[model samples]
Target: MPSAAGTLDWLPLADHLDLVAAPVASAAALVPRARVARIDAGLADTAAFCAAYDVAPGASANCVVVAGRRGGATTYAAVLVLATTRADVNGVVRTELDARKCSFAAHDDAVGLTGMEFGGITPVGLPEGWPVLVDEAVVAAGDVVVGSGLRSSKLLLPAADLLRLPGARALALSRPA
Candidate 1:
């Protein structure tokens, strides 16, 4: 990892599966360039993590789970956007999912469905077939910090690498908030 990567001693994400959620560990192992590091659970949120770690907001991304429901069918997807902005959830995201209404997934629903902690859910390792809506700016960012599916750890990798995961699509997904 680069020395500019704040204070975290990033190492191969695959070697520290125990520090991440189960699904993250499984999917991360395939991304050879990805790295992981431990952090105080209290600093898991984007603002705290960036402040304490000296990471730029532009270099940090947040993953949010959104639910789109129409009739009795519901679709879930993960949205990734730079911390400097916010996902256009009610606009682009809802249209992207092709649902009549959309909103942030309920806390219990997000955690239970993904098997990841509330503040640590990541776009990586999501259930199969769920689209990972990555903001265009995020993919263009060379290096970015992301959740590890565990509040105690974080993932570091080229933001573009996120596109390698299944069902990833680069779009104008966010705007300054």
Candidate 2:
């Protein structure tokens, strides 16, 4: 673990956490003693991050933001998938959100809501009422690498505990990528 006074420049995960809402502290307060890792490599892509970090495919989780549209308004919901698969976003998310149209939010749009850079956003500190869909594969993984509320770090936690966050819900709603 880096020191409390460690430098966060070039560290998206660490820098964002320090600048954004109390995401890390909130997790610790709720889950008790959670530790986040600051990695030197970019975790922007599931495949690349796993290969660079030597993390097994089954151990990685892909966090995605999907735009939910009803009439002319759009809202965003989060979907968590096993890195080995893609979120069945079109099928499950559209239906779940009651959206007439749905698609992935642009990188900039996602970062705005998350206050974290791309590849490192987590559902932990998102606005309440934004649904979080967790693929069953992630639930069964036991542990996962989720965003540290920042772009350069990852929160390592038991998968079950991730579901305890305010809006997290485990669902069997993704297909192999």
Candidate 3:
């Protein structure tokens, strides 16, 4: 598989990610040419990771978990937006989730539910009931880098493949950062 640089040793995502994320990553890998790269956990955050690896910020994606509540019922979603944009949680996302209010998921709740570290949450391994809301811009970026469910690795795959994952839906769900 093609990689950003020889610095990233491309490998099957299932081989490098945590148990909770492995199966999903493995499934995503079935898309032709998908690749994953192991990196320092300390650099998992988008800005640092992109800079350290010489990756363009515009080509990297961020997955953020959000929670919404309505009539005492809570709903969760995973939003995928390019690094250059921010998910429209208060507007588009709230409407899509049919919730009265929406906000980023709490760190503890996110980690506990996803079984992944704070900085490495990705849509690939999310719970079955949660929706994966992907920004239309992400799909147009071609190959993009995303979290691997562990702070120590990142998945690199075509944005088109991401849109194909189960529960994924594309929308104009982002605004400039």
Point to the candidate with the largest lDDT. 1
> What lDDT, from 0 to 1, does candidate 1 have?
0.89
lDDT of 2 by residue, 1-177 (tens): 222212322233332345333645454555443446556645446566666666666776778899989988998988998777888777888898899889999989988877766777787777667888888889898767666666556666567877887778888888888
In order of lDDT, best first, we have: 1, 3, 2
Whole-model alpha-carbon lDDT for candidate 2: 0.70
Pairs of residues clashing in candidate 2:
12-151, 12-152, 13-150, 13-151, 13-152, 13-153
TM-score of each: 0.96, 0.82, 0.89
Residue 71, model 3: Cα distance from true site in angstroms: 1.2
Task: For residue 136, give model 1's deviation from the true position in Å.
Answer: 0.3
Which digits, one per residue and each the tens of the lDDT, describe model 3 over residues 1-177? 223342576776545544325545555644545677778889889888887888878888899999999998999899999999999999999999999999999999898887677898887767777898999999998888888778888878888888777789999999999
Task: Order the candidates by TM-score, highest first.
Answer: 1, 3, 2
Error of 1 at 134 (Å): 0.1
lDDT accuracy of residue 47 in candidate 2: 67
lDDT of 3 at 97: 96
TM-score of 1: 0.96
Model 2 stretches astray by more than 4 angstroms = 1-27, 41-44
